[model samples]
Target: MSSNLLEQLRKMTVVVADTGDIQAIAQFKPQDATTNPSLITAAAQMPEYQEIVDQTLLKAKSDLGAGASQEDILTRAFDRLAVAFGLKILEIIPGRVSTEVDARLSYDTEGTIKKAHELIAQYEAAGIAKERILIKIASTWEGIRAAEVLEKEGIHCNLTLLFGIHQAIACAEAGITLISPFVGRILDWYKKDTGRDSYPAAEDPGVLSVTKIYNYYKKFGYKTEVMGASFRNIGEITELAGCDLLTISPQLLTELQGSTTELPRKLDPAKATAMTIEKIAVDKASYDKMHASDRMASEKLDEGIKGFTKALETLEQLLAERLKKLEEKAAVGV
Candidate 1:
């Protein structure tokens, strides 16, 4: 009998459940789970979580008073709901749960920090320790700066939407807890730009990008961990078997659990040390220039933030409708 690929991969990389589905997290038992506006929006529609949404809405209305505007009420409800989902996921997983700040706040350093504090406070109020929560921020310069401040307060952060080496270096310099370097999104940009149909796992651009970042991090002894995320296929996952971590969706997790393919350790600190890659320092000017020079990194980062922002808008709409129903019920004295 062959060992499950997921099991083998777990030996080298810490597998994080890249989802917001409570049932799915319970099934896979990943060490950690990440949630964004998109995942939260998708999970909010599930019948099982409807009560959570209702409860959050009711609490927001009760706390904010009846005079609060629908926008204010819905906004508070959405934040509570995000925390509610994270709270539930934390019950299933022993490790941390990453709750993202609003994507619209991606460029607002002060706003991001303020939201991070609020999110952490929510978790703390629910009796969840600060250590078990990661504030996920975009890799924008301002977002990274926000994380730097939050980290000083002992608030760990996961810098997301990262694509360029410049972003990784900056996050490390800021003392971020981790950086989720995307794999599939990078591949998508290259495929669209270069007109390449496919590339083998060994030569996959996404795979290589992550490998370089991992090598760079290890070579410099940066404390920030590299978690390969947004995978397109099992090949990308397998190629990064020795990554510090990998946040995988449930579908790929199932594929790995079912397959028995041998997984090789593709990255190592010793190997990275031997490589001749020069370390580059990144400041505001250099960071902007590097991101601009790399079309894929800049485009994808913008697209990712916009995508999350749209999803957040969708979630806000969902909460608004639910809030309306609640308001109607109260008006009718139900």
Candidate 2:
């Protein structure tokens, strides 16, 4: 009798905590939790998580041996940091934890593939089965190709930064495990492009975009699960009640926990199946053409990569400084 919107929503869709904050995951108790460079960087700065971050850095140094370069150590530490946080988060949530590959490798197919292998290896080494983890990669063409390879190897991938039907169709055709469509980011692009301040929830650009993608996937019977992510508000969440999954932020999770709204399911696969939606084939050439035309998708995808790359750079600098401090303190003891 006391269930809130979150409780009601969970009945129809899997809820994933879109955060790296372990405390938030523990509090929300979402089925899954996800992390990216930006989220992990924010979490690393928190005092409570200092021990975890330090341990990851120290372990990376120990594994790489004394002859490793600072850059090598930083790379190793950054990779380990993601799994370190994933391990901590998996301890609290019962479902999978998504860890992102380096954003800098978004356009490098081989680099992305290699990084994915290393990440899976690290997780497997930690005694965690690959089923409990999802390696997140950007939805660039190269990234998708890399995911296609990883999926065949029994390594699942969550394609992120997806904004257009072209990207969604490409991911689906590639047989990716899941795809993350950025609802809020799509809305952000539309608002800026049109110079509009608001949109009715039903007409919201992002909402409509995700609805279209969900319907298409169902109509065509693609198995790649759709997870609407990067939500700007609860309206977006409530509007996508029946999506396969919805990763929500702690702030919005708090709001949903506070209100006992009667949340209704808006996306029905049966209805989508009955609708007449034409399918689109997305190969490299068509993907390029469609991506070029959809200003929102192209711009947002590029911006998202740049933003995440900047965050990773900042995190590396943070680790380098922390490692320096550790070395200085150790020298003092000697």
Candidate 3:
């Protein structure tokens, strides 16, 4: 066993890189990688990836041909831009890459499902398989329902922005492949709500929340996997050391690589199964009722969607500016 905490932790959990930066992914070599609109937009702006951004834009404009509205080009370009990044990520990681559907479709089940198919088709067109791509949808009841339909078609999904048990249980019951409970986001809510600076890693609201969800899934023998995501610090990551997976940012991954502390398993399936925990039957009615009472989940879910939507709007505007520059250069025969 390696003494490094990152290596030690990997013995029990699948480590995933959670950024859109290709250099970081190449450096850390995580098993899987995940990207959202915000990360993609940020990475697309980086000078190193300008070629990727330009190619996606050029292709989108060309495919639409003459008289295509700028809106149509922008929409198609965003979709292709996301997949272009996914393809680059997939080339580096042996596992899967999650490409999210538009956040605006978070509550639209039919639209989410349709978008997932479109993303998957783009990946397949590049000779990648559905198994190597995970469609990331928000954990709304509608999103979970959309995932249920995709899973049956052999397209796996990752239910993201999940904060409460209601959403987690609903995703599991829907037979979703994976659920990424936002550990740090949950903690952020509690700290702001309680007016505290910090909580001990053990008592952190996010850690406790994911621990509860992890055990519940294990105890019930649910096949759905729990991947702890959006961590704020090393404590939260180390606290959930034995989780099925942890999607971490590059900074934290570097810290773990530098630390030699021995990591211990905090979540065990056998222990969970032996504990006496009551089973709660979750459906739309119960999920709605429970979610309504869970302030952190509701608030965070709403805020998270709005945040991603704003990022996407920023990206569209940035792309428009970039497209104009490219067109001007081409017209000048430079």
Top candidate, metric lDDT: 3
TM-scores of the models, in the given order? Answer: 0.98, 0.98, 0.99
Q: Candidate 1: worst 10 consecutive residues by lDDT?
A: 261-270
Cα lDDT tens digits, model 1, 241-293, are 98999999999999999998777888888898888889899999999999999
Q: 1 or 3, which is superior by lDDT? A: 3
* Candidate 3 residue-wise lDDT, 207-306, digit = tens: 9999999999999999999999999999999999899999999999999999998788999999999988899999889999999999899999999999
lDDT of 2 by residue, 229-269 (tens): 99999998999999999999999999988889698889999
Ranking by lDDT: 3, 2, 1
Against the unseen true structure, what C-alpha lDDT does each candidate score?
0.93, 0.94, 0.95
Name the lDDT value of residue 9 in candidate 2. 93
**Candidate 1, superposed: residue stretches over 4 Å from native:** none
